[model samples]
Target chain A: MKRNVVSLTIAVLFLTLAVTGVMGFFLPFNILTVSVHALLGFVFIGSIALHLKNNFRQLKNYFTSKTALLVILCVAALVAVILLQPKPVLAILGLSKNLGPAADRFELKDTKMIYNYTPAPHYKMQLNFKGGRAFDAEKPPRVAIWLENTSRYHLKTLYHSKAPDAQQMLPYWHYKKSEYEKYKAESEAAEKAGKKQSEDVDALSSATPNESFDPADYIVPKDPEKETPYRLLIEINAPDDGNEHYPDQPSLVYVVEVDNKHPRSYQVLDLVGYPKSEMDEEEGEIEWSLLYADGTITTAHDLFDSALLLIERSDPIK
Target chain B: MKRHFFVISLLMLISVWVFFAIKAGEEKTSYQSFQGNIFGTRYQVQYHAHEQLDMDAAEIQAQVEKLLQRIDKIASTWKANSEISRYNRAVAKDEFQLSDELREIITLSEQLKTSTGGAFDIHHQGEEIDVSAIAKGYAVDRIAEYLHDELAIQNFLVEIGGEVKARGHNAKAEPWKVAIYIPPSHSHIVGPRVTLSNTSIATSGLYFRENHIKNAETGHAPDHDLLSCSVIHPSNTTADALATALYVMGAEAGLAWADQNEVEAIFIKSDGSIIKSVQAQR
Candidate 1:
């Protein structure tokens, strides 16, 4: 009776282990499958021990026989092959990983898109442009927002209307952008030739001129700071609404100077000037001379009823 | 005496087998972790293997980053030159051609919008389509697939921002467990926990920030009593969109929608009450 019980226990445990192992292999990783397989495997060892003890004499006869030696040799060979981690065996195991439900495949490719990876700014600059009576949704006016240093050097473009004729619509911004690009190209060429570039070009290439102007590094100096105020500019132009000033009305530029050290809650932009329509023949560039809005400026001034530049400062002093 | 020797030898063999088995289980317990930043948010991936992993941890992380970068290039609205941005800026909306990836995402978004009764919409304020709500979740699903299909990583967890997808068992040979955090306040109080195996969980709410989620019809942030809503699904993209939609739906309507759709979800009310959908009760 004891031998029968031991034999039956081995058979039952072996059946459970086999079932759980197969389930664990086929099914997605789950606690039940793994725990049952691992825990029952230990129990199976105990049952096998009992079975061996119950039939020691029969097992001894079988072990010394040629059949037992052959079985042992076969088991050893299988273990050796698996331990070697051959490519074919690994590939088979890899296939088992995908035995679960199929995943959604994305045929993604590199889109060579140019992305601006600028660091998050300390102050949030929200530009609120209210469309005036002249502002038409059908023929929306092209607008460009950019930042410049106190000395009128172009710093960066905050926003630009994605119109094909954006350059013609915002000539003032286009001229500044062209100037910046030329400087940037010259600096790059000089750097490639291992030549010491001009100090102005080097300053232009850096994110900001002075260390204090670095928005990311908010290091408060003990002494009263001599901070440089940056100018925010916006250029707006309406197409096909030509006024008496020119066939295609020149773009209007708005300017606001902001001091980082002495931050303000709100700063209204002042109507600055429009870039001269004619290009300078000698310089091969659009003349920097700006024309003030006059009687002919008419509907172009009404493109934006009001422009508010709200700045939220993250400084401790503020 | 020979019989005793044979029995002892058999016992020794059993002992060796048990020892090796225990060692293998131990090996599975020690997991390798990889973490990085993507989509202006942090992400983490944890996985384990019974045998040697085919790729190094760094190499796998690089591949994951590359995959995320590609997705960002296609879908990120912040990128001025991205495919989605181009579509948004296009004068003729109908004429604008979308890439296969963007088209698929937009189709999924449209289906979600219909299913949720316009509570979830990517088209915002005429001609603008923002997939910010579902893009992260889609990215999470993509990474999970990459790990499973490309690397053959069976046991892994991928989390980007608050969106998460887990598969198989963890290093401890147990189902992956994730915690859902409630918003507004009360850090000490543990909200809820979800056991994920081949599933995802996404939570959306106005927590520690200004209200960014707006009603699709009204074009303004919805006035609601619920603080946060979390959804669990096999696909992280679906879970993500549902979370945002449920938040807009509030607790009552959200619960009803979740039950009808058989979506497992948990909603935390403003007055510190928790509500679970019928499926989530499990």
Candidate 2:
């Protein structure tokens, strides 16, 4: 009975360790995976320890003769395998020592981590609400509160995912994909006929670029059904006089109106959502909600363009 | 009989020790590489060592190259005889059969696209979201699997482009030293150092790639005001995709998304300002 119980315990412990170790892959960001893996590791160690203790007499007998040779060989093989394991793990994870193991082993203590990668100052800004009635239909449908680049250089285009209701297809999105084929055909015909149709086509295509930026370039589906969020593509250029930061900025700023009933025209100076001190600008995307009369709150491109949109939008190459 | 058995066992131990000791002495370094062709790009794997367990350099490189070629054959925009090329050209619209590589990348991309709200879209046309940025990391992972599972490699580092992964310690018993190239303006690689081990790191800023993050879908400066974005993730694919997406998204949304996802990222705004993830500093 004791022998059977011991076997059952050994089997249970082995099963538990294996199951926990395998579960580690899916629960990568989850802390429980680590805990489970650690627990399993302890169980494995304990199992081996107890088993070795129980087999002490057999181990002694084996060591006295050829059995010892086989045991040593098995251990050597296991060691080789263990030693060989790390390379594949690193490769599979695309991990290197440069990134440091602590990143995976631990999480950042505080959520307010920051760094100084760039050489310039910034006007970090944020508003107080979530994505609320910010997308209410107003004269100009509201987006997150933002500022205008009135900085010196010519304006450039900007792109981002907007709110669900606020999402509007740019004029370009109206064109059926067949339009590209038609344009391509004309251009090709012009090339074959030795005419200036190519230039004309290029001119037509480049027409809206200098004046209006289209948001279709950064289109992303809200769902597989094809609904998408609002995005604005801006185009601006600054002369490269060897400046590190561009003087030109987004000529336009679209802020989500706070009033669900009457979203107001959002302007930078009127944007009191973020603390004045944090309202510095370099060039990046940031989410800003309005505390307007409407109280329309929304997340600004919470995903793709969120980071870029997290900072102020700038046009110049800077 | 007992004495004979003892003598044989001792000899066996000595032989095992001699073989391993010699191997250990000869094993100075190991590396991992990926070689494959996808989207007209040829990828190759090389240099992963696991203390002399099934070390075959040429074969691993060949396998990686073969996988790359296979991907090229299936990628819808792979330029030539590649499957993607036909799909993009509208010639073989029905030929959009997804291969294993395509399916894997697409699945990963779709997951990221939804999670990041299209910030890291793999299906993005115009500059076409090439998985190249993240493929290296995947290749590293694959190489690791091949070595550990197939060949039993234990200690090594793998990298392609600027992304990297490493395991175990170097000859001096130190973690692998991966060097990050400073922005072109800087004279050396001294600034903005991030030390890592047993993890993957990737940078998707225009610092490299000839600043090619323009929006082909809109003929506009896609990365307006954003210089670069580097993301580090437990998964290299996530890091790579996020890096590119965040760079394309520019600064604001990049930082915002980083904050939201609890991801460690660093963004360089167009004006040369850097915004780092709260997680990265820690």
Candidate 3:
């Protein structure tokens, strides 16, 4: 009776391990399956030991036989094959590791920004404005603040002056706005035609808000955790500010490429260049580009005393 | 005898190879995925159809988004005109009228509050009723139901802000697997992974450095050693609420409560040790 009970326990434990092991292979990485398999495996080993001790006389005879040698060799070969971790077995294991939803796993490359506080409702961009020597209360410079990807694609206009000539005053922003409008029109036309449209245009159109100068319209990213490196451009131009270069000085554009991956508390915008456009000789198309500021930019440089962009979070790091 | 043993081993290897080949052949269905921002977070839905799907992925995404927007309109506190917001703004009275959706959610929250011994509460002292904690889970459950009933989708997984509800199997015809993430910081360290079919899993963690979850009884964030708590149940709403309640209850009481209630839970402590409830161990 004692021998039968011990042998039965071994059989039951072996069956349980086999079922759980197969489940562990086919199913996702389940904690319960792993725990049960691991806990029972130890008990299975103990039961095997008891069985060997109970039938020691018969087991010793089988150990010296050729059949026992063949079984030992087969088991050893199986262990060696698994321990080698061949490509096929490794690939199978990789599938088990990826058994969950893609969203559940976080890749190191996904974390581009580290904020002091939670990204949403806390991360903000604060621009400190100081009046320059050429600052006039009656005719303030038409300022446009916008973000652009590294490829110089206009993402969204954060703030734009509500003046009627605001578009004309900021020629670079006007060119980008026209380009965006053209893309938007094309995307809508494509959508209406039931044809696949460029996702870039859709993303841009959705992010670009309606033309409204409400204070509430000046909204930053609600969550900046996934934000990549982008150029923050500020275009300022005073109408009729003529200099030696031409009858009117072109708008001055200030740029600062903010990379959330490597963040800083504050960054000063550097004057990159002004928008320079020329009529194409062959196609009669206007080509818009940026030109370095020359001696003609006199008062345009003084449009702001010092524009500083401060990155602020609700809770500062100690 | 030697020849017999060699032949038997060769036959065993061939049988194993054929079994794997058949399994690989059956896993041919491709999954359709839809993802968008919802409820101040992100949501994803993945499903595969054994038969023809009535709508394309985009149309299904629009329907899901509409459903989630309706729920947001009912429960979102950030929206000034939401149903819950209106209820919060109303003067304290013996009775107040609420929309059916709001009433259902509020009723569910009240039930959870009692079941958890006041560990989970939408109403805080001098604070507006915020159902944001349970809203995502509810949205997930609703989307899963819509996929099953309206679309006739048998295999689907819905996740909103980490709250997940999976029904049937994946495209591979295996149970859907979900990974639990380490909390307080968004890291690559994955905790326990659970496989499910017609089940939901919700994890609540101290996401911010500042205490975010508050105990309804004391109206203060409980100081506990728990880094995160994950609950598994048939209902995402219950799982989501219990995850928060368990976090407030801490590790010891939470483990006991889970076992007593026969709720499946996994608690990760501050010292990085894990404790599984009795049901979860099985």
Candidate 4:
């Protein structure tokens, strides 16, 4: 009974190996075939162990025989022939030329080979600010400044104040408001047509689309927002600052910046600024000036003076 | 006789176990990748085989380098001593003897030239043949073939510069994923990912370091209005030639041509709009 069981197991394992091995050539590499081939391999090993135990003496005599030695020598000779005659074998395989100069005849010179690669550099201007008292000498309001690029894209903001929880400032105008209107129009159209909205429109509806919003939400940010000491969190205002104000509401709001020395009922800055294109060879600098809400004109320097900073170069702070 | 039968069976079983053992060891260290310079750019080869392979990685690399070096010798216009250069330097009317490999490339180029309406021509002024556009693709195909046929490596990815030929599953037993970069993108945000299985892909664009691709008729590079053109085909050589031809033919014409020819392509416009070919959409 034990002999029958061992013979049956060996037969099954052999069949599995044969079937999977043949199928491997005809069929594309698949997980099922590969898994079965691998699993059967382990079973084959165990079955072969049992087979060897039942016929150890015979198996040892077979390896010691002249036929086994001759087979091993033949296999070794074949491998040696293949290794030594690579070019000829490759030529027969249609992978090499039999007559022409061999592939390694000519060596590539070091002059022709490029090893190093340098990426294009990005240019940025830094600004430094000194002590500038707020509009009120007693209760100085936090000063907020917005920086926009040549394309009117809001680059960043620098909020200078004693109150870390100061209310966020607003722009006289925002480019995102236009984008929101555009998205709203498309969403409405898609809804009217009874079609599923695109992922962009869906995400735009679900989340507030601000300067910080990235179109590709599937990607995780490499540097996630952490409470690092030196890291400054800049809050980009929404297109429409939904009816929220602060006398002292502690809630951030878009407020029109004003100069000092004016009373509590001072004029708001309502300015129109056109960003200069960086591509223009003659006029590369962005020129923007502030205007009072009461139609009073102000110089560009006074509004941007505090934000103008010098690029600092220092050794590591040990 | 019974003892002889047991001996033969045991011998066969041991051979099978040894085969499986070697294959398992390879699987544990599967998907061997090797990279080097080829065709004036970088070439990378990655392959995995469950079966026992006769040639190790060093042998495979040696073979692959030989094939690519031969291609450079036959097709490279930069090499003065190359066969193509020799043919170019010969009298216009002289019958130039061509190698089997060069002859094959010329034949393929002739077909592409006819189909692309002379846009993909290899010959310049009807004498100097410049097969650089298609040669890289051919090299990629040759390496992929070496892995598939000579080495019997089915699961493999071969990339020469931006041209790629991929087959079967990756190390994770999933289709190989390739990223298509958006043309003229400011940031290095991840582009759209396409799964490649037994297919070839090649991208042609003005954004590359070299401005070699040009309109054959005009003898000038095409306008940069169309950022890039990427073609996918079963044949890597065809995909490479099509990509270059389509880039020469602006975005609209390229899309139309790709549609008519029933070839898969992706056109990235300067304005950041991506247009997919009929096959790609399907």
lDDT of 3 by residue, B1-282 (tens): 999999999999999999998876655535778775556555678888555776888788878877987897788775567788788888863366787777888889999988888888888656568887788878888898899998889888888867888888876568887766553232333356678789888888764223457777766677777778889999988898889899899999999999999999999876778899999999
What does candidate 4 score on TM?
0.44
Candidate lDDT (C-alpha), each = 0.71, 0.44, 0.70, 0.57
Q: Per-prediction DockQ scores? A: 0.01, 0.02, 0.01, 0.02
lDDT tens digits by residue: candidate 3, A1-318:
389999899889989999998888777568888899999999988888889889999999999999999999999998897676565654564445323222221111121211121112235665555667766656667878776643355656656777899988898988886765554454344333222222211110011111211111122322233234567788888777887777878898988777554578798888899998998654467868899988777988876677777776543211
Q: For each candidate, what TM-score against the reference?
A: 0.47, 0.39, 0.46, 0.44
Ranking by lDDT: 1, 3, 4, 2
Q: Write the per-residue lDDT of candidate 4 for residues A50-164, one digit (tens) a residue.
A: 8888888998999999999998999999889665545455334232212121111211122221111111011111322322221222433333344332113333333323354
Tens digits of per-residue lDDT for model 1, B133-227? 89889999999999998778898898887788899987667888776654314433346667789998888876522346888877666688776
**Model 3 segments more than 4 A misplaced:** A1-318, B1-29, B92-95, B183-190
Chain B, candidate 2: TM?
0.73
Tens-place lDDT digits, model 4, residues B174-280: 88877664422322322445778899888887543324676877777786587677898988889988898988898888889999999998887766678898988
| Chain A vs. native, model 3, TM-score | 0.50
**Fraction of native contacts under 8 Å reproduced by each candidate:** 0.00, 0.00, 0.00, 0.00
CAPRI verdict (incorrect, acceptable, medium, high) for model 2: incorrect
| Model 2 regions lying over 4 Å from their true place | A1-318, B1-25, B29-48, B76-78, B90-95, B124-134, B215-218, B223-225, B268-274
Per-residue lDDT value at A196 in model 1: 28
